[model samples]
Structure formats: structure tokens, C-alpha cells
Target: MSSAGVGCLYGVGVGPGDPELLTLKAVRVLKAAPIIFTPQATGSKDSLALMVARNYVDESRQRLIYASFVMGGTSDGVWSEAAERIAGYLLGGEDVAFLTQGDPLLYGSFMYVMVKVQAAHPTIPIEVVPGVTSITASASRAKMPLVSHGERLAVLPAMYGIDDLRDVLARNDTVVLMKVNRRAMAAVSQLEADGELSRCVFVRRATTPREQIAFSLREIAPEDIDYFSMLILSGKKGQV
Candidate 1:
């Protein structure tokens, strides 16, 4: 596709943790895009998404836009404001690339931007590049298969209550729980009570050097995990 004349909106996914796994198309787009946007959680200055995209950015030709996300504030007017900022640049006929860690559409800030930007300017051209998600990276690092044969997989944020997860766990053959912060232990307890403990595996800092994999959930407990950790449970006992 010729990325000329049109004000293109590129939702670029940087992949999970590792820099080398980035797709060639993502790299080329990052290098050629006239403007790049990296969003930071309001208070933080350095953005992990930008750090990964920096490996391919052509500093001479591209301008970086730092779009900050409100941390504690209500989402009342934030979306419209962010959309306006991005629209301002895009309307100027600039190819703007929004850098996001992992797939842009998967639980990412890029989704928010894409929704609002498109709502504000329907004619703007938007392009999305898929990146290796943490679920895949974590599963690979743990040397575990996410799905096999006719098994189904379900992904839930740990932010969902233990009761919600219990229902999902009972139904899905394979479950991937992301954003398992401090509630790790509680989730583990519930899973263990359901007699699914042995089927569980926990991966911390997936695909990175600090990665950790544990087959026994009881041994490590939830308190030891960081915010970046993910928990996977396979329905069949011997599968993982």
C-alpha cells in the first residue's frame, strides 16, 4: 500500500518484552512514519513502548509525540482530548504511528486512541500491525502449549474478581490470566480449591531475562509476583 498523501494512523505493536521479535513491517513503518506517538501513564516520564520502538525509529525524519494517559482521574473527557491531539497532527497530512507494547488491539491504550481518533475523523486512514502478545511469549518461555487439539482458550485480566475467574476457569479448557498483580495468591487459592492447582503455571517478566516459571502455584505464592506476571491453566492435567 502506498502510504503517501493520506494522513495515516499506524497502530504499531512492539511485541512482548523482546526487541528482536518485532515484525519487519512494523520496523519499516516505524522508520518511515513522519510522526510517532508513545503514551505514558500520566505520572511516568519514560515509556516502555517508546523504548522498544526506539530500536527502529529514524530520528532524522520522525517526530515523537508523548501522549500522556490520566492515571487516577476519571475517563470522562480524556478520550476526546487525546483524540483531538492526534487528529491535529493527522489532519496536517502526517503519517502518525502510535507505539504500543504487544498487540495494539489487545488490552492496549492504542485501542482508546483508535476509537476516539476514528470517531473524530472517519476519513483518516488507519493501519494496524500485529505484534507477539505476552500470552504467547509467556507460554513459549514456560515451554507450555497454550492450546492443543480441540481445546479452547480464554484470557481474563486479574482485575476481574476471583468469582468471575472461577466461572471462566470452570468453563474454558485453557485460561490465560493477565495483569495478575498482588491478587495472585487469592486467585491461586481459588484455583487450588477447584482442584486445578496442578494444572497451573505462572510466568513472571515473560520473555525477559528476569523471567520465572513455576509449575506449582502453592510454592511461590502470589505475593512474590510483580505486576507484569501472567498465570496460565490448562484444563487437561497432563497437557502443560
Candidate 2:
């Protein structure tokens, strides 16, 4: 994509908290981009995506921007503000690479920024460097393949009611529940009711130094669940 008098906006995925899991393309972009934007919670100072790519960034030569967002919905205004802030740098002809924890298009904060920026600046150069997502990482950590040949898969947030998740489970061969931290116990109860407890496993921060795993869902308590954790349920026997 060619654009006159504007810098490119890159949606870069750093991948599930593991520095080593970062793709060569992600590292290349991080190093080459003059402006790097990371997302953080309103009151938080850390961004997992930035932490994952910190080694590749030269602080003295690059400018780092943190776009804060309210975790659960209600972040529209903030997204717009962030887009404007990024646009300032783009207008100055500095390439901006916004870092996301996983694939930018999949549940990443970058997705929100991407939409706003694209809507506001239709002619701006935009590129996305996809990286590993927690869904597949959780599956691999548990030795569970998300799907085989013809199997269908569904990825849903556990924060929603079980009735919603149950409906998806009924149709898909593999069900991946993201954000299982908030509803860990509820999810376990629903899985038990559906006779799917044994087929599920919990994986936290897959491939990271602080990664945690539980082959049995009951072993983990909702209170102890991490925000980055997930539950991967494979309907049939296919684990290693």
C-alpha cells in the first residue's frame, strides 16, 4: 500500500508473553519502527506485549507510547484518543508499530485502534504482522490439538453465561474458552454438567517463564486464576 506524506501504521503481535515466541517479522518491525505503541490498563504501568518485545526496542532511539484502555468495554473514548495520538506521529512521517499480546485481529487492543485509525485516515498506510494467539498456545501446552482434519472449533470468552458457551460447545468439535479467569468455577460446573470436564485443561501464559498448567479443571480455583489463562476443551481423545 502506497501513501503520500504519511507514515505507516503497523499492528504488531508480540505473542503470549514469551519473548522467544516472537516471530522474526515482529522483531524486524519493532527494530525498524521509530514509534512503538503499547496498550495498558488505566491504572497499570505494564504491558505484556511491550515486555515481550523490550529486548528488541532501543529506548534511546525510539519513542514509546502507551494507550490506556478500560479492560471491560467502556473504552471507546480512549480508543479514539489513542488513534489521534498515533496519528500525530504518523503525520510527522514516523512509522508507528502498535504492540499487541497476540494476533492483532483476534481480541487484541490493537484491533480497536486499527478500526479507529482506518476510519479516520482512510488513506493512511496500514500493515499487520500476525503472531501466535493464546488459543493455539493453550492447546499446544496441554498437548491438545485445537482440531483435526474436518473438526470445527469455537473460541468464546468464559466471562459470558454458560448457556452461551454450552450452545457453542454443542456445535463445535473443539471449544476454547478465553478469559476463563473470571468464571473458572462456573465453567467447571457447566463442563461437568455437559460431561466435558475430563476433556478440558487450563493453561496460563503459555510458553512463558511464568506459564502454569492444569490437566484437570477442578485443580484450579477461580480465585487463583490469572487474567491471561484459558481453558481448552477437545471433545475427543487426541492429547499427547
Candidate 3:
């Protein structure tokens, strides 16, 4: 396709599970784009990102593209494939928007696709729109302050293991743990051992229909944890 016919690409963050949390710029871009792309997990019925963005996008006027991207899988092929599919639309001069569940740069699959697409088509224009992250949403839903003045904040993925979790907990005034699915109990155990369980708050699927908020880790069952769950540990306690 000719360079003149190529369209711009937008990486839009739909926000943490809430459609209303979507930024105005994100909605504007979604409305203007001719095509929308969202990532779906393998064997999933629908894309969560797309579900969050459905209210803003005009489905009848825009074409939807669902790309399969498995979580915790060690492979770059899926990202490359998704990029190529999006490139096809861009080559035809159709502006494309790729929706992500949270901030596109924070533990999101959009970064992988963005890198691949940009590497292959350096000249194509691209933009990234930030959104409300799960950390902030969880804090808000739990009615807790993530940090106060002069407090250090550290965000870590639970997959990094318990040792790192302990270290961060000791040093940071506020620690946000993300992707704590199967590791929920392990994380809880560590916090309990350190005498920090009382300061911990757990939130699952924040701001969504399935949302669950726990003031204490003990209040949540291991089976209740989901991939979208997050844990917040503050050195000081807040109203629960």
C-alpha cells in the first residue's frame, strides 16, 4: 500500500474495568477511528478491554478486531501477528485504535504490540492515551490513601516472588501488589508473618460488576482471587 494511504495508530487505555473511567481523549479517538482492536485471552468469549469500551464506540460504524494474547505465556508470535493484522487496516487508510484494560504502559499487552508495529513501520504515526490504573481504582474503591506526603510508593507484581515483596514492604511507605491471582495466599502469609496483614487491602476486579473489596486479606478466600486482583499495603492505616 502507498504511504499516502496509511493511517495513524492509537494505543488507548480503557481504564481499570470501568467504562466511565475512560478519558475524554480515549473516547474521541475511539469514535474517530474506523477500526478498533482489543486483546482476548485464549478460549475467552470476549475482550475485557472491548467490553469496557463498548459504550463509547459506535459498533455499527466501526469494525472490531479481536486478537488472542495469552497471559504469562512465553512467546512473541502472538504480538507480531496482532501487529500485522492491525497493519493491514492501517495500510488501507483506516485509523485503528487498540484498547487496553489499564494504562497501556503498565503491565499491559499493548506495549508489546506497539513495539512490534513501530519496529516494522517506523514512519506510521502512533499515539498513547493514559487511563486510570488498577492501583488508583483499587485505592479509591477501598477508600484508602495510597500515599501521604513524604511517603514512598512502590508498585510490584506478585509474580516476582515473596522475597522481593518483603524487601519492598520494609522500605516503602506504601506498596501496591498487582497480578496476585494464585499467589494471593502466599502474599497473605508473608504479610501476616511480617505483622502487616492489618494494613493490607485487597481488591478484585475493581469498579466492575464482579468487583470485590477486602479491608483485610483474611476476609478473602483463595478461590475468590482472579487475575485482575490487586493488593495494597500501607504503613499507616486508613478508614476501612
Candidate 4:
């Protein structure tokens, strides 16, 4: 990774919510990179990962590039427009670091960028730096382990349909459900009916100042949970 070798792309993970949980390597790459790109949903007012990185970034030097948008173009053409802007920086030979809230490759917006960049510039070297995901953070906070002897762990984004959710729960011993929001209540309820809810732990805004942990989903206030939450369910007793 020479400075002049077209300046590689780094998908650096900042960890789930906690700025301090960022790996030393992630920090080093972030600070050294001349261009730091953070993802923001097309209409979002603020970028959470960027806000967390701001706590460590040297404001005087590093240039901030807001790579705003989701994979699908918005009605206002904001998403495609934002992608083009980010592509411009990468094509300009800048060592760009695409920062994400959790491990960059794990359900992070970095995947969208990586795919776009690869299609546009096949020779570009993209590096991925792993960071602790929300599941691990939630587990640590709740003193729960996602894995135990003979226990299989499956991670599913709450975006799954009811059938899919039920199927996964029936198959896996331990499951970590992400992107939990109001829409996920039905699936959560199903988990209870399956006799797995009591073994579940819910962490909302894990690792941040607003962090909340609930041993049972029933204990969580309906108005409190949003997409930022994660649910960790353990299997049988003695599995941990």
C-alpha cells in the first residue's frame, strides 16, 4: 500500500456504537487517510458512524466526505447522485476510508460501495478491517455468549419476512436478530411462542450512551426500540 499506488480503498469498521471499541488498526487507518467517507441514508439528517468517528478524528486535517444514500436510488435522485460523488473521490487517487458503524462488511453500507467501485474500477484494491458487531457487543453487555458447545448461531436482519423468521428460529440454537424495529414485534412474539423468548436478550443502541439491555422482549417499552436494536437468543439452559 504505497501512497502513490492509486491509494487503496479501506472499508474500516468503527465497532457497534462505541467509539472506544474501534480496533487500533481501524483508528490508524482512519487518522492517516486523507479522505474519510461515511455513509448516510439519502434523507438522514445525520450519520451515526461519522459522529462516532468525529470523537477521534483530527478536525484540522482529515477531509470528510459524506457518502450519503442507500443502494436503491431515492425518488429525488439523491442516492445515485451521492454514489457518483463518492466514485469521483476514489477515481482521483485518494486513499479513501469508507467508515461504518459496525464491521464494514457485515450489513454495513460499505458493501454497496464496494460493489460499485469494483464494477467501475476492477483493479482497485479494497481492504476490509473487522470490528466488533452489535451481536458481540450486545452479548458482552448482557454477559451472554452467542455460541456454546454444539450450539449453532444464525444472524438474521429483522428485514426477513414472517415465514423466514419462523424458519430460522426453528433451525438455529442461538440467533442474533438485527435491524429490529416495530415491524419485528410479530417475529419476536413468535419466538416467545416457540419457548425461546425467555432466553433472549435485547440490546437497544448497544455500546452507546443511550444503551439499554432487556432480558426479555416483554420488558422493553414498545416506543423505545427502533431499527438500531439487536436481539440475542440463547438456546437451552447449560448451553452457555
RMSD of candidate 3 to the true fold? 3.5
Taking the tens digit of each residue's C-alpha lDDT, what string does model 3 give over 1-240? 236888988999999988999999999999999899989888899999999999888888988888886775654898899899898788778888999988999988889989998999897788899989999999999999987899899997774566666666667888887888666457566666667544878889999999999877668877888788888875424312
Global lDDT of model 4: 0.76
Name the better of 1 and 2 by lDDT.
2
**Weakest 10 consecutive residues, lDDT, candidate 1?**
70-79
- Candidate 2 yields a Cα-based lDDT of 0.80
Q: After superposition, which runs of candidate 3 have C-alpha atoms over 4 Å from their true positions?
A: 1-4, 159-161, 235-240
TM-score of each: 0.87, 0.91, 0.90, 0.85
Q: At residue 93, give the lDDT of candidate 3.
A: 82
- The best candidate in terms of lDDT: 3
Per-residue lDDT tens digits of candidate 2, residues 13-110? 99887788899999999999989999888777787788899999999999998877777557888889999999888888889999998899999888
Model 1 ranges with Cα > 4 A deviation: 1-4, 70-76, 159-163, 219-223, 235-240
The deviation in Å at residue 238 for candidate 1 is: 15
lDDT of 4 by residue, 103-192 (tens): 877887777777777877787778998988887888898888777799788987774566666566567777788878777766776656
Where does candidate 2 stray beyond 4 Å?
1-3, 235-240
lDDT sort, best first:
3, 2, 1, 4
